[model samples]
Target: MNAPLKITKVGNSAGLILPKEVLAHLNAAVGENLTVVFTTRGIELSAADPDFDQQMAAARDVMARRKRALRELAK
Candidate 1:
């Protein structure tokens, strides 16, 4: 499942163009956001979870507001 990928210039940033077969295997299309995760082995790419991201943002806001309470509860 290894395919050679080339990094090309896209304005100021560099981008990689995935082959059609790889795109088909990932079920990804143009304009879709992908999440890149860095692991010990290597980098992993997956489709972004918009809903999960939104939920995490909300949780972070709540945690910020309730920092004192959460700290006490953790004791």
Candidate 2:
């Protein structure tokens, strides 16, 4: 849906207030976190995925523990 967004002062930071329809479209609610991704075209906002966050954390842990191994693999 095409929705015009305006950036307004939000506690010293500029923020956009999502309309109710936009929130519904994103399946998000107030106080919920949204993931921001910067793309070549522009930016993308989406609902945060708990599973992805957990997977990324696990991957980071493994990378830290296997730093040398990972470096060797990269080479």
Candidate 3:
């Protein structure tokens, strides 16, 4: 699962080419969008989900507006 990847120049920006085996393991195809997440441990790459992102944004807005209500409900 662990494989070394190299960053090569692509036009102006550098890009890393994922191995075919890695792509197949992740069920990713060429031209498919991927999401990069930075955590305390390290960087993570995963398939992008636009629908999930929208839903999370809506949920965050609701939580921000109803913080007290949610706290009371949790009690």
Better of 1 and 2 by lDDT: 2
Error of 2 at 36 (Å): 0.6
TM-score of 3: 0.66
lDDT (C-alpha) at residue 71 in model 3: 100
Task: Rank candidates by TM-score, best first.
Answer: 2, 1, 3
Q: Cα RMSD (Å) per model?
A: 1.9, 1.4, 3.4
lDDT of 2 by residue, 1-75 (tens): 786899999897899989999889889999999999999999998998869989999999999999999999998
How accurate locally is residue 10 in candidate 2, as Cα lDDT from 0 to 100? 83
**What TM-score do all the candidates reach, one by one?**
0.78, 0.86, 0.66
User: Which predicted model would earn the best TM-score?
Assistant: 2
Candidate 3 achieves a global lDDT of 0.91
Which has the higher TM-score value, candidate number 1 or candidate number 2?
2
lDDT of each residue in 1-75, candidate 3, tens digit only? 888999999998999999999788767899998889999999988877869889999999999999999999999
lDDT-superior candidate, 2 or 3:
2
Model 3 CA lDDT for position 55: 98
Model 3 spans with C-alpha error above 4 angstroms:
56-75
TM-score of 2: 0.86
